[model samples]
Target: MHIAEGFLPPAHAIAWGVASAPFVVHGVRSLTREVREHPESTLLLGASGAFTFVLSALKLPSVTGSCSHPTGTGLGAILFRPPIMAVLGTITLLFQALLLAHGGLTTLGANVFSMAIVGPWAGYGVYRLLRRWDVPLMVTVFFGAFVADLSTYCVTSVQLALAFPDPGSGFLGALGKFGSIFAVTQIPLAVSEGLLTVIVMRLLVQSSRGELTRLGVLLTKSATAAAKSGAVAR
Candidate 1:
């Protein structure tokens, strides 16, 4: 979700920008380290950025000065972690603001906080938890995407509510209103994104198993062999 220009009060905007600066720096460092450590990840990282750009660019009108859409940060976070997603997601948001005239430049920090930072962390957390519990691959992927998309909107709702709370009902009421508006459109979009991500992951698994294994999403040869042996013994 993109909060249009001038929607947030200057104070709120500035505060968010200040808050996001450290994360952005950390993300840049993380990405830089990734490039140096694993040059082979260059292609996958580029593809991840492109995916984020494409998915986020497709917008749907929501409440005033804002919109709902599928955030592709989850997939990247699952593959590359939230720190890397933060960098790529900010770049994607920046491009959408400048080139497509979709989001706004002034609100980039707020947008990046909600979509890039919060969304990816939430999704990646869910994914890791599920993976630890031995959830099915497809199921984990779907939930990761779904949770990431939903979490982004939730953070957006909070940001909007904080910036423009209802006078009579106050912040909680405003949050509820904004959340409701997003839920109408966002619920279905999250599910769609989840399913679509699963498909994409399946394709990647088939075409780039080596990369997936490198990313630790797929079992290595020894692990697979061990798993098969354990299954046979069981």
Candidate 2:
């Protein structure tokens, strides 16, 4: 969900900008390494972003608006890297706002922080954590997409609350309002995203030529790929 300008007070914008700064820096660094290490994957990276842009912008009927869309957080994190995904998303949102006006220009940073930066990072983090616990691939994907969507909505809701503190929309209330408005649409979409992410991840992991190539975990070609394959098998 793109937060329009005036959706949040100026203070909210500043606060989010400050919070997003570190992620931007870290993302840039991570992307640089990814490009350096896997030059062959840059095309794949761009394609991943295109997939996200299309999925996110496709008009899915929703109570709020058909504008409601799914982010490719899980897909990106599963295949590439989360930081790279953030940058890809930032580009997608920027262009979408400029050409389609799906979101506001002035609020680009704010929107980026909520949807591109925050959502993907949270999804990636949770996915990694669950992986450590031997969680199933399908379950991990579902949870990642679910968390990413909710996190974006939470940020959007909080921004709205900041704008109209008296909308009487506390965090939970805002969450309820936003969730209710989109739940019927989001629930099914999330399941779809999760399935898509899992299938893609499974495909990539299985087809990887080297051990380290598995799971995009950046390990030595043999050991890492073997480790990843073993994990996936479990």
Candidate 3:
């Protein structure tokens, strides 16, 4: 979802910008380190950024100042990590704001805070938690993407509600209104994004098995066997 230009109050915009700066800065460092250490990952990283840009650009009318769309952060967050996904998501949002006018520059900070920071972190957390409990890979991936897509809208609702609370019912009422409006479109979009992410992950599993294994997205049979041998030796 994108917040149109000048939609947020000046104070709210500035507050969001200030709040989001550190995460973006840290993301920049993380992205740089990833590229430096694993130059081979550059291609996949570019693909991740492109995926976010393409999916999020398909915005549909939703809440007044915002729109609904797939976030496309979960795949990258799973393949790389949330910190790197933050950088990818920021770049995607910035381009969309400048080229497509889908979102506004003034609201970039708030947008990034939601889609880039919170969405990826929340989705990755869910994926990791589920994986630890021995959830199936594709199942975890689906939920990861689903959460990432939905969580962005949730944060956007909070931002809008805070900026323009209901006169009669206050912030809670405003939050409910915005959240309900977003959910109308966001739920299906989240499910679609989840399935799409699983498809992409399946393709990667077939074509980039080595890279996926290196990234710990998959474990090769040889690697598994080696690990078992090592454990036996120990």
Best by the lDDT measure: 3
- Please give each candidate's TM-score: 0.91, 0.79, 0.91
- Cα deviation at 137, candidate 2, in Å, is 3.0
- Give a tens-digit lDDT track for model 1, residues 1-234: 788877888998888888888998999999999999999999999999988877886675543445667888888998899999999999998888888776677898899999999999999999989986779988999999999999998988999999889999999999999988775568788887898889889999999999998888888889878877887798
Q: TM-score for model 1?
A: 0.91
Model 1 bad stretches (over 4 Å): 60-67, 224-234
Show model 2 residue runs off by greater than 4 Å: 62-67, 167-175, 182-185, 206-234
Query: How do the residues 93-211 of candidate 3 rate in per-residue lDDT, one tens digit apiece?
Result: 88888988867788999999999999999999999989766689999999999999999989999999999999999999999998887755698889889998999999998899989
Model-by-model lDDT, in order?
0.87, 0.69, 0.88
* Selected candidate, larger lDDT, 2 vs 3: 3
Worst 10 residues of 2 by lDDT: 209-218
Candidate 2 lDDT, tens digit per residue, 144-227? 866776576566666665555445646667656665655545665666666666666566567654532444443455875787
Position 146, candidate 3: lDDT: 93
